[model samples]
Target: MTITIERTRTAPQPTRQQPAADPKPATGSFQTVQPDLEVTAPLGERYDEILTPEALAFLARLHDRFAHTRHELLAVRLQTRVDAANGRDPKFLPETEWIRNDTTWRVAGAGPGLEDRRVEITGPTDRKMAINALNSGAKVWLADHEDATSPTWANVVEGQLSLFDFLRGNLEYTSPEGKEYRVTASETPTIVFRPRGWHLVEKHLKFHDRAGRAMHASGSLVDFGLYFFHNAKALIEGGRGPYFYLPKLESHREAKLWNDIFTFAEEELGIPHGTIRATVLIETIQAAFQMDEILYELRDHCAGLNAGRWDYIFSIVKTFRSRGRRWVMPDRKQITMTVPFMRAYTELLVQTCHKRGAHAIGGMSAFIPNRRDPEVTERALAAVSADKRREAGDGFDGTWVAHPDLIPTARAEFDAVLGERPNQVDRLRDDVQVTAAQLLDIPSGSGEVTEAGVYDNVSICIRYIESWLRGTGAAAIDNLMEDAATAEISRSQVWQWLHDNTVTAEGTRIDQTSIVRIMAAAVADLPRFEGDRFDDAISVFRSVALEPEFPTFLTVGAYARFL
Candidate 1:
């Protein structure tokens, strides 16, 4: 049975079906929360292969079982942030000290295609991109739907269809200019899907709660459910099972929730237990402090841990936005891996992951080479080589890239270190000792906020949000793959600098007056678009970056406005 969306190319929206909110729970051990499924946008050609009744029903089952837990966890996140903003600071969890102290337990061995992830290219699941990524010669492709994808109904549904086709060896695309792209089976990277973070919700699919009031489904579950429901068996039967890159995890309890969801899904689908493996991104400041415990919670299904450097910085800003000038960050460019605080985070991550026998993956190098300029390309390649060399020397099993061109550079670095070995999990970095004080030291930057930097932030945020509103999450700006993380850090630095009323190195004080002028200039500088996406982007940026209270994520507010 085909379940195509009602597509409208201009602004594709899911069709509406507001089923009367039933005030009572359904009968049986599981109270069935039947969602009023609506295909708001037109499902493009061949979408039926993924949006079938069976697939939606499978997602519904996942929602019925785990939706409540997801809500409670979100509540916990809110309260936790509130506490941090209200003077309660994040530190090592004493309660889960036992999990951290236990050194004997190890995560299940790397399942299938995850054994060698020396170079992973990350991008959205667009049709041509999907085929190109698979044939990118990288060891793994992070099929991203989270920060890297704009969650328009069309993008959400079509991305699923694209992955479905790739998995079945039926994926191919021709560009608007008539360039053919097809997946090369020989060079195809093992696919690892990165679902949206837990904080967001899929507003179109409204499922009733126990009280029978309609509510949006969890974005994490929607992405995970649809993918797992349809392709788990096929993936397992082939070389690799279903693998995931879990993002924005803030606590070990959240990790436990994911492990439980995986167990339940495996049982329901009759797949063998432990077939699903996930690499958790320790993005939030809170998660960085609990890396060991996070691994312990998902040890049964954990593949490893990734140092999500960009969001980690964004989290530091959000968590301490209202704190004194001590937490005020300098320019975003000043914050690098070499900084004492960042070094503490990455070193601790490797120590924690390797001590527990899990792969310690490095953060992303978001440099896109400019092929037209030989000098520019050479400089970019040198920077990428240096970054990967540092990671390999520091005991990271692998590193991630935003473009396919950097794969050779990254792989060569890891290969030089690994020789014939797939990974260096055995090289436990016992020499690294990180303290809480060092990790919390936010003074590594020069404390120089320049007006140029501020204007740059405003422009990038506006440009990024404009692209995002137009259904592109990953935008190429200044030869970098700028995702939500970039925008988050950008808007966040502005807010932080403003809250502290920081004076730029050029003697310009950052205040509302200066910011409004910058905003106006940014809007004027934007290229003409025939739609209100530009205006909406400006409003969203101002609201999030200039508001009295900081929103957890810029994407959360913008998601409601756009998608």
Candidate 2:
């Protein structure tokens, strides 16, 4: 059935079940939790293939065993942030110093289909993008269900279905303009799926706990559970194990939680232990200091680490945006991979991952090629080429690109580095010595916050939020790929600049009055459509960017209200 979403075309929602009212809490173990959990979203065609009873039961089991731990870790994150905000600054952990000092341990290096991740195209797992990614000639496809996807119930459910169909060799798509495309390629890229981060919840699925209390299901469990439950065996049979890109983890404890989940999932499904491989994104400030411990905790199943640069910057702001002008940063474009602070982070990451036999993947540049403008495309290619070359030369085994157009450029850079080899993990980069001060150096970069920077942040944040509220998470704006991660940095910078009372190079002070004028101009400049959500976007931007207290994530609040 065609469901009427507030879009130009119909978007299908998931198939829901109105289970009998069961207010009773669950007993010990997952049996009780699985039966009482309810799927509240309405249904659509072929939804049963993904939302089967078995899948929900598996999902509930994951929640049952690990939900409390997830909550506790989230609490630790809040306290840690609070501590930073209150002048309790962070340093390398004294307690886990043993893990860092011990240099003998190593992660179970690249599994099949993951060895040569030289050029990975990162995007949402929607049909069109999935097909483009698979056929993009990249070595790996970061099948993203996290920031790149709008977490509508349809997107959540259909993403699994799309991956399932692609794995089964039956996936295809046709444009509304009557062009048909099949998911065929000379060699499909290795698929590494990214589940949502731990901080959010899947409100559509309500779980009743032992206390007889109903709460939202864990988004991580829902996304990972459905995907793993349905396709683990098939993936193993097809020469690829179930791989994951874990996002926004704050500590080694969180890594241990995922390691435990992987172990349990392998056993429950009769797969051999260590069949699951995960590459954790060191997005948050806390996780940056725990790289060695994180790899150690997941050594049995760990594959590598990725420098989630956009969120890393946003994480820094969220942690210390309210402190003072000393912690205040410059424009977003100014913080490149070569910056002293970012260089320390990436160097330390490479050192830690290489010491433990894991791939060090670089971050995406976000400068996607604009096809309509040849000069813009040329400039984007140059920018992306420079970015990828820096990573390739700096001892990274692989890197990520947002658009398929940049795959050749990224691969060329890595190809020049690793001509006949799959990766350079053996290059331990032991000469790279980093300290806590270098990693947390807030005053290193040199750039001024200009009026142009302020306008860019406000307009980009509003434009991105509008697209997201319209059910499109990823969009092209100003010759770059703008997703939830980039949007977070954009809005956070606006908030950070305004909160710190930043003055531009022209001596223009960033205050509520200036922000309002900029936001009004941004909204008015957009091409108005009948179903646009600019109003809601403005409200979301206002709440997250201009509010007194920071919301941990912009998507969490906007998703609750709009999606």
Q: How many pairs of residues collide in each model?
A: 9, 3
Task: Give the clashing residue pairs of candidate 2, or none.
Answer: 14-42, 14-43, 15-43
The C-alpha stretches of model 1 lying farther than 4 A from their native spots are 1-42, 529-532
Lowest-sum lDDT 10-residue window in model 1: 7-16
How accurate locally, in lDDT, is each candidate? Answer: 0.85, 0.86
All predictions: root-mean-square deviation over Cα? 5.4, 5.8
Local error of candidate 2 at residue 267 (angstroms):
1.1
TM for candidate 2 is: 0.94
Best by lDDT: 2
Which 10 successive residues of model 2 have the least lDDT summed? 2-11
- Native-to-model Cα distance after best TM-score fit, residue 551 in candidate 2, in Å: 0.7
Instruction: Write candidate 1's Cα lDDT for 1-563 as tens digits.
Output: 22432212222232222123234445765443334344434556766666676666566667767888888988999999889989888889889888888878998858998888899999999998888788889988999999999998778878998888877888888999999998876857888899999988887665544434566778898899889988898898788999999999998889999999999889878888889999999889999889988888888899999999999999999999888888998888878788889989999999898888899899899988888888988988998999999999999999999998899999999999999999999998889988888888997655578988899899999889989999999999878889999999999999999989999999989999999998888778788857748888889998999989788899888888767
